[model samples]
Target: MLQIITEKFFPPGERYETLHRAILYTNYRVMRGEKIITPIGYLLPSTGLHSLATLTCEMLEKQEKYPDGPKLGVFVATTGDDLLNDFAAVISFFLNVTCTPDPDLTRRLLLAERPSLGIEAVPSRFIRRMFDKDVHARDGEAAALTAFIKQLIGLERETFVGAMRAIRQFVIGSHRLADDLNLAYTLFVTSIESLAQGFDGHVAEWSDYDPRKRKKIDGALKDASDEVAAGVRDAILSNEHVALARRFRDFAMAHVAPSFFRVEAAGAQGPISGPDLPIALQQAYSIRSSYVHLLRDVPRQLTISGFPEATEVDDRKTLSFAGLSRLSRHIIMQFIARGRIVEREAFDYRRELPGIVTVKLSPEYWVASTGGFDHKTAPVRLAAFLEQITAAVLQHQKDAKLTDLGPILTMVEHSVSGLRKPSQRLPMLTLYFLFHQFAGPEFSCKQWPALFEKHKADFDAPTVESFVAHLITGNRVEWTLEQLEELHKTYFKTRHTASVTKIGLLLEAALSLYVAEVNRLAGNNARARALVAFAVDSHPGHAALRTYEASLPAELAEINWTGILLPPRPSSEGPSADPVPAA
Candidate 1:
C-alpha cells in the first residue's frame, strides 16, 4: 500500500527515494510482527495503518488542499511506532473534518494548520499544539518565520529539506560512538552551507529586481576592486560567491563573530593566528569531500595537536561539532531576519516607494538621466547634481586644506536618492551649498551662482525669481562697514539668510569695483573714490573680497570713501540717499 502511494504521488527524487526505502523497511518489520517504538509512544495496529494509508491517498489526490501532504505522509510512514499513535490521531481528525458537511469550517481548520504543516508537522497533537501556542505568542516573529518557510519552499525546497534532514541525523548521531562523529560534522556543515545559499538567493533577488540598488552595489563593487582580494572582488561584482561557504565565513566574521574571535596575532617571533570561520568551513568541507571520494588513509582522528606530548583529541571533535552547530543556528537566524526585513518592505508603502520609482525609471536612467521636466525627472537631476558636485569637491580637496566634506556629500546623496516629494529637492540643494561654502575655497563661492544661473529655467518661477530679486535689491541698498562685517560673519557660518543676503552683496560689490577700476584708469579720481566707497561700505568684511579692496589705489582708501551706494544711477533706480564723501 505504501509503495503504491509513493509511486503515485511522490516524484522521482532523493527525498522520494528515502521515502521508498523507509516504507520497504517498515513493511519488512510489520511482516515479521515486530513492534516499533519512537520517542513519543508505541506504534499503531494494522487497521490504523490501513486507515492512515487510505486517508493519505485521499489527501494526495487533493494535494492542492493539503500542500504539505506528501512530506507529512513520508514522515508518518517512516517514523517509529512510538510516534504512530499521535500521527494516526492527526490523520483521523483531518479525515473526519475534511469529510464533514461544513466545508467552510474544514477550510478554516486546514488554513490554520498550513503554517505548521511542512516544517513543524509531527505525529503528536500535543507537541504540535505547544509549538502552535508559542508561535501565536510571538506573532511578529511567526510571520517572519512563515515568510522564510514559504520562500524556502518556493525557491530552495531541495536544499532546505536537505538541511533539515541533516539536522535530524546529527541530533540522532550525537549520542552514539565516535564512529558517528564524522557523519554529524559533515551534516552540520552541509546544513550551514545550504542556509547560506538560501540567503544568497534572497539577496540576489533583491538586487536583481531593484535596479537603483543594483547600480549602487555595482558602483561599490567597482570601487572595491583595488581593496578586496580577487575572489572577493569577483564575488561582489558577479554575486557568484554568495552561495559558497566562503561567503558565509566572511559574513559571520563581519556580523556574527566578536572582535576577539576574528583574529589573534602572536608576538613578533610567532606566526600570526586567527580563528577564521571560512578556514574551518573549508577544512570541514574537505573532510566531507574525502569521505565522498573514498580517499585513502583518511584521518579518522578528529583532533589537532600542536605538540605530541599533549594527547587531548576527544574534546577537539566535540568542539568542532559544537562550533558547526552554533554556526548553523546563526546562519538560520540571519535568514529569518533577512526575510523579516524583506516582508516588511514588501507590504509597507513608505518603504517600497523608492524602489518602485527606481523600477519605473531604470530603463531611461540606467546609463544617465534622460527625461524632460516631470515628477520622475527630479531624482535624475538631483543625482546628476550630486555627482558633479562630489567630483568637483573631491578634486578641490586634493590641493586645498579644508574640513572633511565627505559626510555631508554622502548625506546629500542619500537624501536625493530617497526623495519622494518636490519640496525636498531645494532643502537638499541648500545643504549642498552650505557644505560647499565651508569646504571649498574662495573660488567655490562663485560656483553656486553660476549653476543657479545656468539652471534657472529648469527651476520653478518662484525659486528663480526670488534669487534674481535678491541680486537687484542688494545693488540698490546702502551699507556701513559694521553691517558688512555682520553679513560676513553670517555668510561664514553658511546660515541660509546670510547666504541669501551676502551672495547678492558680493555680486554687487564685484560690479562696483569693476566700475571704480575703469574710472580710476580714465583719470576720474573723484568718481573712482565714490564707487570705491560704495563697494567698501556694502561688502568690505569678506576675506576673499578684502584682497580686491586692498589692491585699490592707496589714495582712494585715504580719501575715506564710506556710506556710498553706486554713484546715484539715473532714472527711477537711482540711489535714495546722498553718497557719503571721503572723511
Candidate 2:
C-alpha cells in the first residue's frame, strides 16, 4: 500500500528523489526545534507514487488468496479515498491473507472497528497523560514506558490533544528541534519559491478512473501537514511568545513601515505584490531582530572619554543600524544551515569595523561642524593616535633592534601602497602607519617581512578578512606596502636577459659614482646646483654621462690618450702616460 501510494505521486522519479531528500530534511527539522535560526541547506518535496504501488500490490496478492471466497469484489469496490481514510485497513487485510494464521495486533485492529483502533491512537493517548505531574509515574523510565504504551491505546479526543501537547512541548524544549524548525522553514520557503517559478498556473489532470492515485497524494499532503504543524508548534513553544510579538512590532516600525515607500516604488516586483512574501520577510526580520537583541547581543557598549554625554540618538541608531546588519547576517546563516541560503566559505561586505573602515554603520557620512572632531577629523585623529601608540610599543620592544633592516624596510615599503593621498590613510593602511608609528619607522622597515613570512601559513583562508586580525593578534610585524613590495622583490627576482641585468648593474654603479662626486664639491651652493641640475634632467642616461664628463676640470677631461687599462692594444703603441688612471 505504501509503495503504491508513493509511486502514484512520484511518477517521474525526480519528484520521488527530491521528495525523499525533503522528507529526510524535514525529519531532521522535526528533531531540531527553535534554534531554527541556525543555518540549514535546501530540501526537496515528496511525491505520492510509492504509496499507491504498495496498495495495489497488496490488493493483488489478497485477491489471489481469496479467489474462491467472499472477498473477490471487496477490494475492487474500494476507492483511493476509502483507502486513505483507513490507512491501517490495507495492512490488516493483507495480514489476514498472508500471515501465519493471524497476528495478535492485526486481529485486534481488524476487530476494533472504530477510530480508537486507528494505528496511532493508543500511543498518542499514553504519551499525553504520562508527563503530567499529577499522573502517578513510578520513575522516569516508567513514565516513558507508560507514555509509549498508552499512546497505542487508541486516541480518545482528550488523549489526542494531550499527546499533541506533550509532543509539542518536547519538541520546543529540544535544542535539536529548534534548529530543525529554522532550517526547515527556510528550506521550505526556498523550495516553494523555486516551485512557484515553474507554476504559471499550468497543471496536468489525472483521469477520473485513476482516482486511487489522487487519494495517495492527498494522504501524503495530509502527512506533510502533520509534520508542518508539529514543527510550528515546537517553534512557538521554544521561544518567549511575548518577545516574538514585541519583535514583530519593532520590525514593523523600523523596517516595514519606513520602507513601505521602497516597496511601492518596486511596484509589481515588490514584496507587496509577491505571494505570501510580506509574511515571510516580516517573520524572517522579526526572528533575526529577536536573536540579535536577545541572543547575539549587538549594539555593543560605546565608551566615550572626555565627552560631555552620549545622546539618545546614539543608542537608538545603535540598535537600529548595527543591530539590523548583525541580525541580517544571523538570519542569512540560519537560512544557509536550513538549506535555504547557499553557503560561501567567505563573505566580504567591504566596510566593517569603525576603526578599520572610515564609514561607520550609520547613514550619516561627513559631519562639517564639530570643530576639531567632526566625522572627517575623528577617523584621521584616531588613525594618528593609533600610529603613535604602535610606534611607542615597538620602541619599547628593544629586542627587535638586532634584526635585519631588510624585513623592517619591507613593512614600511608595503605601508606606502595603502596611503590614500587625499586623507592619507586608508582603513587598512592605518594599521601599517600605526605599526611604523609605534615600532618606530626604523623597526617597521626592518622586521616586518620576516615576521609576516614566519606566520604566513597560520593565516585563516575561510574568511580572508582576518589578515588584519592575524597581524594585530600576532604583533610580530609592522606592515606597509612599501616594505611589502621590497620583500616581494627580495623573494622573487625578475628573470630578464643577462644583458638587462648588466645594464642595471652598470647604471647603479654610475649613479653611485655621481652622488659621491657631488658630495666632494667645494661649496654647498655648488653641490646644490649640481644636484638640482641632475634632478631636473629629462634624460637620465644623457644627464648621467654629462654629469660625469662635467664633474672634473678641463685638464682632467682632456687626458684620454690610451693608458687606461692599456687602452686596447693601440696600433701605435702610443707612449701616452697620463699617470694611467686606476682600473
Q: Best TM-score goes to which candidate?
A: 1
lDDT of 1 by residue, 229-312 (tens): 445544655644333445544454443534223331111112112444445555666666565567422243433212121111
lDDT tens digits, residues 397-492, model 2?
222122122322343345544443422323223333334433434344444455445434333221111222333234323334334334323322
Instruction: Mark the 10 consecutive residues where model 1 has the least summed lDDT.
Output: 20-29
Candidate 2's C-alpha runs over 4 A off are: 1-131, 134-421, 424-583
Model 1 misplaced stretches (Cα beyond 4 Å): 1-179, 201-245, 251-279, 294-319, 340-583
Model 1 / residue 188 / CA error / Å: 1.6
TM-scores of the models, in the given order?
0.24, 0.16
lDDT of 2: 0.28
lDDT of model 1, residue 417: 40
User: How big is the RMSD of model 2?
Assistant: 31.5
Instruction: For candidate 2, give the lDDT of residue 539.
Output: 30
